[model samples]
Target: MESADETNTKLNGKSPSPVRSTRPKRSVRLTVKPKCFRCDKCKCEFSDQTNLDYHVSIHATDKPFHCETCQLLFSKRASLKAHVRTHSAAASAAKKKVFKCDNCGSKFTTSSHLKRHTRTHTGEKPFVCDVCGSKFTQNSHLKSHARKHTTDKLFACKNCPSKFSRGSDLKAHVRSHVVEKTLKCDSCDAKFSKKSHLVRHKRKHSGERPFHCDQCAAAFPENYMLKRHMRRHSGEKLFHCDICGSKFLEKLYLKRHMYTHSTEKPFHCDTCGSNFSQKIYLKSHMLVHNGEKRYQCEMCDSKFLRRQHLTIHIRKHTGERPHQCTICLSKFLTSSNLKTHLRTHTGEKPYHCDTCGSNFSENSTLKDHMRTHTGEKPFWCSICGSSFIKNSNLKSHMRKHTGEKPFHCNICASDFSQSSSLKKHMQTHLNKYQPL
Candidate 1:
């Protein structure tokens, strides 16, 4: 039987042990059991001794492999070798000369990177996840995607109470809490947390549409946008609301839609003391108090607090009714307007009043009907001490205070505040001009 010192000498190819063995030099033909190496930190068991040695080094602070350019230490020599390429790639990028892709004319510092880019044209996904069978062109993407299957959250945020599986995602999330935006666009004053976000923003300025849909002629600036657009053709709604049984194109939209079902309003307005289910709704409502209209129409002098409102206003000038009803053949400027029109045809009154037990097709109409029961007069006249349930009625009442008559008679040029009053005044002229 060989000694432990003799085994170490055989494994490492080093000199013989300095200390003498206490055991007798006897040929012990004992049955040798297979050794199972277990990691103390992660509690992972390995059959191979070489694999266990590599796994144990990851938990240690002292790294044997170090990059010469960045001086960044790595536990494994392969990781250090990979880190050296980033330095050489950056240096080659400064020279503006590298291996170019013949298909897309995209340049890469390394031939390996150029080969990976060529896979985009070839529609090849070499790396695949074993757990979920998800494929990717790069091995790094497959490793990142594999984290979704695991329950481990190795990276934790210091600023917020959040954890991430990947260190890169944690770093990106940390920037959201901090005001620091390191990446800035060259053409615009817009800044972003990551270089990828800055690159995506720059595409808006450059009018570059890199990702194109194979099914249709639609193209997008980003791959995620193209993936989202592909869902329209595929008729795939990945997210669904359990309460209303309504499906949505995106997960974020479904999360926002869930706020409607929630009775609790966490976000409160400081000015009006109004509560909102979501923080974004409260932020938008705050713009009304501040009178901030950031979005403006290019075709008209109309301005809106929200971009969606500005987009709807632009359709009035352009006469572009993109939303069409299949049942009535009616066109609408916005999807909300089309939805309301569909409710009229289908008799789908979604908005219901709890107090009166009355249902309304439109939410605005239900809100107005709610004022009747609650006696909540939100609109108020500044000139008089009068309050109104509707804003349109308040505007009509304001015309009486200002003495500005909008409704005028064509014959006598007589003006009136209310349209009904003008119609009654026109009857007097009609009686005078009657052939008796």
Candidate 2:
């Protein structure tokens, strides 16, 4: 046998020692040569050296890496690479329930979210707040909260000239600007913004209201939305008004009320000259202007600006009499509606016509009806000298008198009093009805 140093000389073509060796010797003296053995059938050595017994046909046939959970097996290197995922998934399922957070009491379907949340209680904020000396568990929470100070609003809306600090907030804000939501439900073809929004909007489509209020028995699609609604019954005014003793359940509502006290008409409708403090208020006001009622009564198919309005609209159809008129035994859906109804019985039309002796249900309604008598058209049509109750009504009513109908029909030359009416009339040709 050749010496260890002589064996190196043969492997490297250089002599380190005078002693001759054929095979190179290792200092550790490994018992195994880490090489494949020759098979008797073919008299060939295997190429793979990781497992010398891989050359054995019987041992190579059994894939020990088979996943019990996924029941996947592998024979080749490529197949084993694919099959290892099943073992990893099974291992992940095993490690899932083991490491959990004690703070938020959240269970992770994967250990990643639990790991991220654990950093909160450990005072390990991987995400640091640049604004104040605050730290958060999520980068998104830091991103959204940062908008309160800096106006680095980068998220621009595709529909409108609006920007938001956060991408999700921008997505949510864009929903209020447009009437259409392209993302439809799998169960029902209802459209909405986010998946959660789609889920909530689906309740409007299927009427599958699951969350019910304990205090007033009012139902909502989402539990969080229901929690916000429950504050109405609980009278838990969490959002306190800075100006007065008044408080609101919603922060947005309180913000809008602050505008009312300040008379700050921030948002304005481009189509109609109507102004509003809240974006939703502007959108709802456009309903009266365009005569576009997206929300329809579940019973009568009559439309309204809001779901609450539609809920009120359904009482007229269901006749599930809610409010009782204490004076005249008349049962109505709303207290204000009953109060308006009582005026007809009592002949106490507080809202009187200045030009005629006509009394009405509501003061605004009476004010509106007075215009018909007095011809005092405060809402003048630019196309014609027609005055009306609201500027939007005047615009709609002007189309009826002017014969200059801008909203033309694809099927016919039919004109309408309102743009909404023209759109609905055009739908007659396509036979396209509102989807639920």
- Tell me each candidate's RMSD, in Å, in order: 17.0, 26.0
lDDT of the candidates, in the order given: 0.76, 0.62
Looking at model 1, residue 426 earns an lDDT score of 88
Residue-level lDDT tens digits of model 1 in 1-436: 9999888998999897578889989886976556588766555677778888877776555566765433456878877887889767655574763687676565655788667767656757798889977677688878877998898876666667687887688767966786678777889788875455566687789988866665468988876798799666544454656555556889999999887654467999888787798999997788899977889888778889888888788889989999999997999998888988988888877666777779888766876787898797878899887999988889999998999899989988998899999999989989998999
Please give the range of 10 consecutive residues that has the lowest summed lDDT in model 2.
Answer: 64-73
**Index of the highest-lDDT prediction:** 1
Candidate 2 lDDT for residue 248: 64
For 285-398, candidate 2 gives per-residue lDDT tens digits of: 777766666786655657776788888767766777788877878898887778678777777644445456665556557555655665755677676566666666876676
Segments in model 1 whose C-alpha atoms lie over 4 Å from true places? 1-213, 216-229, 242-245, 261-264, 291-300, 404-436
* TM-score, structure 2 vs. true: 0.28
Q: Whole-model lDDT for model 2 versus the true structure?
A: 0.62
Model 2, position 79, has a per-residue lDDT of 59
RMSD of 1: 17.0
